[model samples]
Target chain A: MQQVQQQTTSDPILEIRGLTQNFGGLRAVSDFNVTLAGKQLTGLIGPNGAGKTTVFNLVSGFYQPSEGQILVDGVPTAGLKPHKVTALGVARTFQNIRLWNDMSVMDNIRVAQHYRLGYGFFHSAVRSKRYRQREEEIAREATELLEIFELKKYADEYPRNLPYGTQRKLEIARALSIHPKLLLLDEPAAGLNSSDIHELIRLIRWIHDRFDVTIWMIEHHMDVMMELCTHIKVIDFGQTIAEGTPDDIRNHPAVVTAYLGDDKI
Target chain B: MLRRYSVHLILATLGGLVVYLAYNEYLGLYYLSVLMFMGVNIILSSSLNLVNGYMGEFSCGHAGFMCVGAYVASVLGVWLFARDRVFGAPVLDPEYALYAFPVIILAGGIAAALAGLLVAFPSYKTRGDYLAIITIAANYIIISAIENMSAIGGSRGFMGMKGVINAMEDTIYLPWMPIWVFIFTIFSVWVIRRYVSSTFGKGVNAISQDEVAAEIMSVNTNKIKTITFMLSSGLAGIGGGLFAYILGYVNPGSFNILKSTEIMVMVYLGGMGSLSGSILAAILFTILLELLRPLQIIKWIVIPLVLIILMQFRPEGIMGNRELGQTFPRLKKFYRFK
Candidate 1:
């Protein structure tokens, strides 16, 4: 962990210390610890039921931890709601592509800026000068975002109407609209075919290079993990089994047992 | 800019025409009252649509907030502008009632909005059917609370809002109730439209579609839910205030579960999340109610049957989720709803 911290010069964006979460008697995640800094791409991987998604949920403030602390930019996010946590410069995508299906694609991007809309209900209802300027700004920026992501053609279309791969792309675009310092991608390649997976890899790499965001992604695809992640952490049954470079993780005995079981079996 | 406000211009002209006809006695009292009720229904349906359609919360107790508004506005109007049996002499001159009526109605709306917190607070942890039951209970609690207050006439009902209208009429010799109803109806719809179009307001839509995703995406689900419920209930309160003055009386029995169900029917009939559809449904539903008045008790049975048939044929309602402009593209040239 200290060696990982030494690799990056900037201060840590996400610092988790002894995080633990229990769903009744079942321990979903326990004693998880990681310190991510700068703009490095990190990956979390494990077999099914390895508490991978649970860790993402904990970091994103969706689930309160049983014990431990999470800090975003060194500000404690222990009791903050998800939106408040997001306001501290964190954004995430779901494993299941949880875009607002009924809303138009443009709205999906626009609504992510809800935390910084800069106006209140009265401003909106009365359409004050401030409201007009803010709304116009939001619209212009949302348009620009869609253009950059090459999704402007589907601006007026609903998310459910978009193709599955395009929907995933749109979800990532929506997440990026928040301008988060730390971006959490949970299973971005979950349902994509080979070509879309290739496209996703390129998109993720481009986004990491272009957006200046520190990305932490969870993926089952070993190639995606190996290709994109500078560092990989493996967990099984809520326990951290391996942590190192992708090459080290690919050959680590504990990781292999966690994924493929032991040779004796 | 002219095209942007063309819809407002047309609505204003229609409102002015109605006021002119009513003031001249060219429109009879029956028609005037029917029009006033239509306005009230418009306020009710569109406001309820904000919660039920836009926010996607099953709030079946909308009338409870309306009842709170009706009583508050009625009592305030009487206490300030007219002599009341419970409150004795008027605090202000009756002559001022004409200008102060809107303030009284808005006060009622504010009160109803505060009352909406009853449901809004519980909504953070509960949703769907569980929230529905809480809202239904809240409706009962509100009605029962008023029924137990003997100072306000309790179950026997409350009166004196008629005197406020009469005072306004004496000052200006105008159709005060109809004009006020029309103004408030338009006002509520405009407020809802502006709210739902703003980025801040789109949080309501985000919550309805997927709340977890909404919260994680930086949409403050709780704040948005609170605002939506309050706005929805506050508008309904305005409708209730107008209804009280229109009938010159208010009874707790009038704002019961049946009344709430009527508003819900209007919301679903117009289509969820469509402002134009809600307005259209409110107008059509009000007219249908009046037309079926000859059936008296049978009207209830007929209304539900119609709703059943509507659900069977088009469960998404007349507009589904699209606005009138989206459905009829030609309307886009005449008006921009956003």
Candidate 2:
């Protein structure tokens, strides 16, 4: 670490209060509230269909909560669209990798910087001096990101050609390229083998320490959650049941009943 | 720094040389007509390519916008330049007609772009098959609505555009229609090429691949769709204006669903998301239509069969969404028309 003062360090970057979501008649998430301090590494773990992903969708502005509010960096974002939330410095990766399959890996990373690019369509078409300078910067940034993920060698290849683990890594690299203040990883370790899970845990830890951002990940694997996340929030039946440090969450009664059994926890 | 404009300089010079040759009568009338139609097809296919190919929207009503453009451009062209049929001699002097031609075409483009917004707004709520149906219905609605308007000739169609061309010729002794068509075609292709190679264009590809992810990535999917549709429809309008000039008449029947399908075939055959492919497909398709003219009704059957074979063998189309610059690295030095 360079002993740099991160922008997200002092204040709570995300504050959710009474956030509730309903799909048709069924409540998918109800009265969900949590607060993440800047630079906190948090985990959201639940059993299958525990509405873990729903919370991610709500915070990222994919769904308007049937009720309640979400504030990011002190600004309310209840009815904002996903792109607007992203512009507010919240970036997320889907449970299933959603990389642009036809684009080259390098282009995938560059696409996330779509808003930050100051030039308009006319400048790009004419390839003006500002366009050239900005484009060079985008390329350099994308290359640097790829280098961090060990994907520099595969920059020209399409995402579909990458192996499973590498594809997952590429998605993370893409989300990071947005320079988000809050990073949400929805089941980041889903479908990975044990060795790959170990690699991912290491990567997530490195990201938490290296990047000047807060992280909240949804994981089904308790081992990964316990090892990587300093704070943990547990949800079941579309409601938050327990939240504390990983050790306290491991010993919580409601969490044990909802997800991890007494024996497993 | 100025070396980047060499490709544009070369293209401009080539266009001028062709116009010069046409003026000198070096090319026969038949060849001149063929070249003009090629230019028109290039505009149609390339503009449609923006929506159908790169944007990955199933827009079956492209000709609806074209119809709007054609009527708007033709009616204005005749109203200003050919007043003999309506009231008396031309209200606007023939001397000004040549200068006013591009403005008239641009007006047509603006009208068509407005019409495009009508369709684009519905796209925010619907997508894929539902949006396709909306566009198809839009095509029918435009044609039927125009056919019902007897003031502009109704189903019988509208004429008098030829008089505007004649007015221009009477003012200046030069082949103006071909020159203007060639220039507009090049301009349309140039603008679209510039658009697709830009960051905005890449947002289009991202939407096509995965829309939700693109939205989450801060790519305003709705804004991009609206802009792309408007741009595509506007260029189609310009092509339609050129088309009305070439035919010297505008008929509601000329821009039916079949016309839209024809453009769609060119788009798919050329390869989705490739500007060079659009140009190549437009040329080859125009030639194919001419070659098949002898077969008449059988040509329709044969054309669909050819498309079927193409889809079966090369489903991604001729260029497979890769631009010419990507296919041939050596061409990269010539221009970055990626």
Candidate 3:
């Protein structure tokens, strides 16, 4: 927990301390802590029911922290609504793909860019000159984001018609439109092929570099977890068992046991 | 682009055509008043559509807000017409009557917006079935509260504006309230359609699709909900205002749960999120209600039967949540050539 504090002060984008989430009688996540540095990818990996998603829920304001401190950019975030938290530059994607399926793909991205693209009442309501300019800017930005995700071809179509891989990328693209300081991806590569995984890694790296956004990824794919995350945190039964670089996490005795069940790493 | 401008102009021209057609063919006093009701219903349905269809929240208290608008508008009309006489003379000088109606209607919209703010506040914490219940409760509460207000005549109802209507008729031999209805109906439809297509309405759709995802995307769901709710309720208020003028009386019993259900039917029948769908449905609903008039009380049976058929064959309703332009893009394209 103290180390979580130190991380917040020294080279940290997000710091979680003494985090605990209990589902009725069950302790889904208890006394867990993780630190994500700026502009780097951190992987959160564990077996089923290891409370990986629950931790993300706590940090993202989907679920209030049961007993923990979440500091984003050194500001303690307690009791802030999800949108307020998002405005503070922390954004996330769900494990289940959640897109506005009925709306145009362009609309999905533009809505995300809405608060950022500011204008006045006459502009928006009466189609004032400023509002028109804002709309064009929003459209351009949305189109640009769509193009990057390789989804420009389907810009006019709804998300429901999009292929699974493209949908995932579009989700990421929508998140980036907010210009967040930290991005939390619940499971980017969950149901993707090796080819898709390759594309996702490149995209993630590209986002990290181009957008200067820190990423905290929760993924079951070992290869993705091992390859992308600059640092790794391993959780088991709601406790942090091992925490280090990918190689350190891979070699940690408890992590090896957690993965291989007493078999050598 | 200039092409978009031309497209807008063409749309306006078509709207003009619809108004001309309605006037040329359907302008008797009774039918004219019905046209006013139709316009009001269009505003109500489209506004409710924003919350129920576009924002995808189940709001069942539109009539309650409409009652608020009606009472406020009527009260203001009475007060202003009194000319410092306070509670006297519900109608002022004859020629100025048109001015009063629009003022009352606008006041009604603003008052309804306030009521919407109240309903919207609680919705921030809940959604789906629970919110629906709150809205329904709000509807009942508004009706009951208004019914309890003795100053407003309570359940007995109130009247004042007939003198204004009489004055207009005394001056102009062939005064038509339907003309006002047709124009305002056009105004209401055009405003809602354009609003929904703009960037702001994109937020409404975001709330419907995925609220959490929307917030994370930097879309302010709370602001959108609040604004959308107010706008939707305000439109319902305007509908009620027009309704009051059309009926020449105001009563709590008039805008009951059945009225809210009526608007809901129109919205769903038109397609949940479709603006043009609501208009089409409102018109069809009015006509169907009239056609079933011969059946008398049996019309209620036919209404549900049509709803059942709608659900079975095309649950999306007549327009399936699509606008006239969206449903038939070719219609829009054809007009655009001009």
The numbered model that scores best in lDDT is 1
Candidate fnat values, all: 0.95, 0.70, 0.72
**1 or 2, greater by TM-score:** 1
TM-score for all models, in order of appearance: 0.97, 0.94, 0.90
- Residue by residue across B74-103, what tens digits does model 2's lDDT show? 988888888645535777887789999999
Question: Candidate 3 - CAPRI tier?
Answer: medium
| Residue pairs that clash (backbone atoms under 3 angstroms), model 1 | none
Q: Order of all candidates by lDDT, from best down to worst?
A: 1, 2, 3
For residues A96-162, write the lDDT of model 1, one tens digit per residue. 9999998899999999999989999999978899999999999999999999999999999999998
- Looking at chain B only, the TM-scores across the models are 0.98, 0.95, 0.88
Error of 1 at A162 (Å): 1.4
Model 1, chain B only, scores a TM-score of 0.98
Q: What is residue A133's positional error in candidate 2, in angstroms?
A: 3.6
TM-score of 1: 0.97
Predicted complexes: DockQ each: 0.88, 0.66, 0.60
Ranking by DockQ: 1, 2, 3
- The candidate scoring highest on DockQ is 1
